[model samples]
Target: MELSCKVNYALLALLELARHRERGKLVQIEQIAADYQIPDRYLAQLLMTLRRCGIVRSQRGAKGGYLLAREPGQITLLEVFTCLEGTWSHKQESQAASLTQAHFAIEEIWQEATMAATAVLQRYTLEDLRQKRDEGQQFNPMYYI
Candidate 1:
């Protein structure tokens, strides 16, 4: 399936937010975009969508930015995908390149892959993700001074 630029950007943006979930404080869009190399304006749009979905909350004016609407442990990648990517509930029609038999066969593979992926993603919470990232950095080759 073809994922849209918005979906990719939103996922990257969400990962950034997830990393900062422990702070439980508003984080600026500029900071998030800079860390992920994403465009600030584009991220603002995605955050707005997430905000609407009640996944994130934003503050205005000085000392204003954004924060997760819920705790990190309560957030799941599935929810992120659902809010940003939408659910994959529709089955596509057969293309001319494939025969009728191939169409249903391809659909089965697609369904299995989607279900397995969803199951794996739903198993980890944002806090678990943060701990994993922290662990990797701790085991890096660089020795402490």
Candidate 2:
């Protein structure tokens, strides 16, 4: 399955927030956008959506910005996915009544696949991602001139 650019950007934006969550400082949209090369307008829109869903909170002032509403460990990737992408079911509800046995079998397999993917997503929280990213950074090989 392909990850949409919108969802990818949302996750990256969240990761940025997660990284700074411990400092209790709000991260501005421009900083996140510039760091990840995401468009400012698009990231703003995504952040608003996240805020509405209680995944992140926004402040309005001279030093205003955004911060996670909950800790990174409390937010699952599946939660973010559902917030941005909606429910993950791929079944065609309208076609359910017309399916033949062969179609039913194929659909059953599809459902299993979807469930597996959902489980994987649910198992990972933003904290898990942050740790993985930190580990990768630590293991990267350096080439000195």
lDDT for each residue of candidate 2 in 23-56, tens digit (9 for 90 to 100): 9999999999999999999999999999999999
lDDT of 2: 0.91
The TM-score of predicted model 1 comes to 0.79
Q: Highest TM-score among the candidates is held by which one?
A: 2
How does each model score on TM-score? 0.79, 0.92
Write the residue-wise lDDT of candidate 1 on 1-96 in tens digits.
566788777766666777666676678999989987889999998999999998888889999988888877888877777888778764666566
Single out the weakest 10-residue window by summed lDDT for candidate 2: 88-97
